[model samples]
Target: MVDSTLPLFDEMPPAGQVAAFKAAFDAWLAEQRGSGSLRQDGSVAVYEDMWEAFAAWCLSQSPVVTLSSLDLADLQAFQSARFGRKSSDLSLTPRYALRLMRLIDRVLRHHASRTEAVANPAAADWIAANPEIRYADAAHADPLPEYLSVSEARQLIAFLSSARPRPGKSRDAQAPLTWQEVRNRASVGLQLGAGLTPGDVRALTLDSPVSQGSRVRERPWKLQVPGNGNSPARETPVAPWAAELLQHWLVVRTEAGIAGTFLFPSTRTGKQWQKPSQYECAKRVLEEAGADSREGGSFRLRHTFALRQLRRGTSPQQVAGWLGIEPSKMKRYERVLPGVIEVV
Candidate 1:
């Protein structure tokens, strides 16, 4: 087996060159880790694994051992070795290989800039020349995102509302819940009501604002506020139905003795909120109600609400603010997906 610690320098390098290269790599890695750029996650692990494979293949081909010793010929050979190999096919995609190379290039470039090493130019050039190339568009069919029509949305809600609860007295019992009828309606209402995301809904605590007569407030939606990061905060208005459903949920909360910060607690636990679980439950409800639209799922509720707001003459800027999206991103929603909505 190849020595994992071997540097990529020629002839295994002199003791001094090996020490210098190791020192440079150590320092660069420290900086990346400390600066929060390099996450110690599966992505980084996969990149490292590919790099090890490439390094091993290079060592097998040439006497070189340190990154600095790698040349254009070695780069080409590494790509060739990786291309369509069994390991590559089974463990990695071409995209994965390309990503690994780019990550290696980034590390090398960082090291080169700091160390003023000779490898910088070649590494940079290789990265530029063989960047994980891609076709402009996907080769596979691009099924336009499935979306719900207004009528379909209405039907979905009606179906979910009418679904009988499972054979039990518990409200949480399995029932034909429709997004339109309950979860989807509730989701759309919350989004329209308070401009909340699936995350925000999960994060909503009892302390979140509500109406006595006709008012609502909460910390900005999860995606809107800057607390998670440096992103700016935005406050958006909620639609009437969202406000009502939220109010209704509060009533259910009281009966369930659901006391906590989370606004949308699990019907089972009634004490904690989980976005994925709730979404899945919502999907189940929709499926049971037979509310599948051309868009195929409840994601269209969000789309429908946004499109409705736009068709009502809401400006892109306003919609963007409401949805907690950058205005540039709002341009895509200016026109609703075909069959997803009708003009009021």
Candidate 2:
């Protein structure tokens, strides 16, 4: 029944009606799935769980939850509770829970869309303000970011330079070194030179757009990287050396008869290989480079690049953009480097 005093078109189902509402919501969710709007990007189930957790919190309330009864303050309360920002049964850890709050907002939006109800004002506020960078346990001392020494970094780069370069503009960029060598050199180059995550290097396409400044300077090339990690698709700087290596690899890749959309497609599968294979390849490069197994791995390549940038006096904000990570996350790298502003 419609209530004239109520804000929504229909009342949020009472406790007895909660079961029915759940069934109906499930039906709506199925519809969303069928329509392909609720795309499975690995977080769909998590959203559902978050929604169910919100519902449980509502059910445990003093006056009980309903359309009119659940106001803006109530929504804020739920946001706090879910992230352990307030007292609740949700076990979400403080580290990732702040990020998880956005998913909870998404669920509420879906509910509001289906029910024609007043949207969660608190969630809107949280999304707008995006909350300050308040991590849990602020008192804890952070660990220093790991990095390779300049000598080791040089060794790492030199070790991966297996492709033989060809001279002359008329010739292809590289001579025979097998397709695997081409892929290995290019892969490591991007991680170390461009500060790209391993996944980003793998996901890069042969036809993926590249942007370069016309002024013609060193490291002028930047890749419009596809979305990697939690970051949106953003332009990432590619050092001149890495760019040179990439052009060379393209020639060898063609010679080896590898054809795929990916910049470094697997010769066996014609698609990007997973991290396990990437790790194996990285270990081989490290072995050849004489880099300690404990010190150098696939991810450490990115860390080395990031730390170098910090050492070069780039601001944390700038480095964060370069590496596709949160600015606050850069503090770990910053703690190790002394007086960034004074470096230049």
Candidate 3:
């Protein structure tokens, strides 16, 4: 629904107030596309989609829907209606609801400014009705992010690079095959170095020439990592250390008589790795590397990757786009950024 290409008011009669405002909203979003504030990641589309969904919902509820006509009751209805929407599975998370409301807030504010209206009474009413509409602080939340220090990450990566089941632990079900250790190292490197999830790593195809032919002894560079779900793929710069480790494993992966579509395949057979098997491998790797005790499963690496970015002064907006994290989820990492908190 929202037509980004159409004019807000051109060729419209003066009586078309609601259509004018809706057009203005879409036009504003179109302009936002060029701004650094708007993410190039698919999230921009998702944001648009939320607004469109709200618009469609409003149309269903009332024939003449306008920003000024909307009140606190209407907004509440929209929030409650998510329970009935098939996309959200009837369980609209608080965080999702907040972003939708925020975008509603943003659009009304912009609409007022564009129209030179005295004030946005509807926006005011919604704000007053829900004072706690924003995301919570991650710094003080339960289950704080588990991150490894730079040195600790290095230690873990080192262990993973050489990790294989000891002869004594051969009976253990969690032990990775010796050759599979190499694959695990490469897979973990993406998470530790570039913030990719296991799914993101599993989604990678090794048949490409860059992956199949890149040399560690030669020029090292970045690669585009595909994202899962609505998240867009991002180009991740490969650090020499991570590149060396990944490339080493690639060679070993090839030599092990494993040839499959995936970058990391099952050790039992060179085929796609199922989700459960992926988790088992991750648990085994973390246990061996002393990172098994982290509260969040596998997600900690993603958190660590995000934390590292914030620590190094990367903008939260850019980092969010790079990591495919939603607006609410980024708050957890925002409070930990430098200058926001004290370090003892």
Candidate 4:
């Protein structure tokens, strides 16, 4: 059993380089833990086990794969040996493969940071340049995301369109719809029409719905979805029918005198709505529409929007742009395209 606490030598022979690398990585992990950067949790054990397994594999190689000679090819060979079809007992699922890849990349990056001589083989740019390094075993990939059928979507839209707030009494039944009801309709409409995530919907300002000086009630309303570190800002056109619902809400919003910049704010405080409140709103709306509220959250609404575009002869790349996701992520949506038989 190799002791991880073993101190690395300034110079080591090819045979002992792997052990030295492991020692350095272990020491780094310990330092991180001591600094409160890494938690003392099951995840630390996972990292240890994965690194030990990888180091052992390196020692077992015919030429003894060492730190100095380690490169993309070496990593690829190790991945194939451990996870490819030949290893029936240790065949890798996509999830495990992804985790393994992440572990290896982190370890390699740490090693590179300490030892300037050794280049990190798993550097993001290098791996991106060599796309084959990514686990692309489509056969074992997770199933396509769930989305609403056309009929279900239509039903949901109809329910939202005619939905009115319940009256307090028989005489008050003729009262107009509340602003909250209109806001809920607009929120759901943005998700179902523009493929906006709940975060995207929450991040919107009063001016988000307007596009190129277009008015609130205008046709072809383009929604400006704000972005964070992961995705860039994008503008997507809301479906005309959904835009109509949104228009009604915008009018109600102004008249209601809600004192917030956020397009959807708390009805009472006019502050940003909490995540649970948004989720509950979506759930209640789904339940009211007789849709599967259990599995059909805001994400399902976005997925439905994606699927709808794909089914309507829109290119996957175009749809991906609309959804503010990478084009590669759209591959899953392609599985459900018309005439495409989805293999279980």
TM-scores of all predicted structures: 0.46, 0.53, 0.50, 0.54
- In candidate 4 the C-alpha lDDT for residue 107 amounts to 69
Q: Which prediction has more favorable lDDT, 1 or 3?
A: 3
lDDT of 1 at 269: 51
Per-residue CA lDDT of candidate 3, range 1-344, in tens? Answer: 99899778534233565466568568668667767668676977787778777876766553445667776557766776777768745237655666677677778777778778754555444433332343232334433455665666777777865543333554255555577766776677767766777677777766321443355444234556666664677666555566666666766677777866677887546688755566556766777887764245566677787877676777778788767766676776665554333210
Residues 125-145, model 1: lDDT tens digits: 444333233211235322232
User: Cα RMSD for candidate 4?
Assistant: 16.9
- Whole-model lDDT values for every prediction: 0.53, 0.63, 0.64, 0.69
Question: Cα deviation of 6 in candidate 3 (Å)?
Answer: 67
User: RMSD to native for every prediction?
Assistant: 17.4, 16.8, 17.8, 16.9
Candidate 4's error at 233, in angstroms? 1.1
- TM-score-superior candidate, 3 or 4: 4
Candidate 3 clash pair list: none
Per residue, candidate 2 scores C-alpha lDDT tens digits across 1-344 of 87668676533447574774365457657777899888885756766676577667776776666433555456556656655555554455554455555555555566677778866544444332222322233455454545676677777776665454534533455454667866877788888888877678777786553645524432237777788655667776766667777766776677677766787776645677655466556656667778744433455677777877777777889989988878898888767676333211
Query: Which one wins by lDDT: 3 or 4?
Result: 4
- Where does model 4 exceed 4 Å of error? 1-142, 163-175, 211-220, 339-344
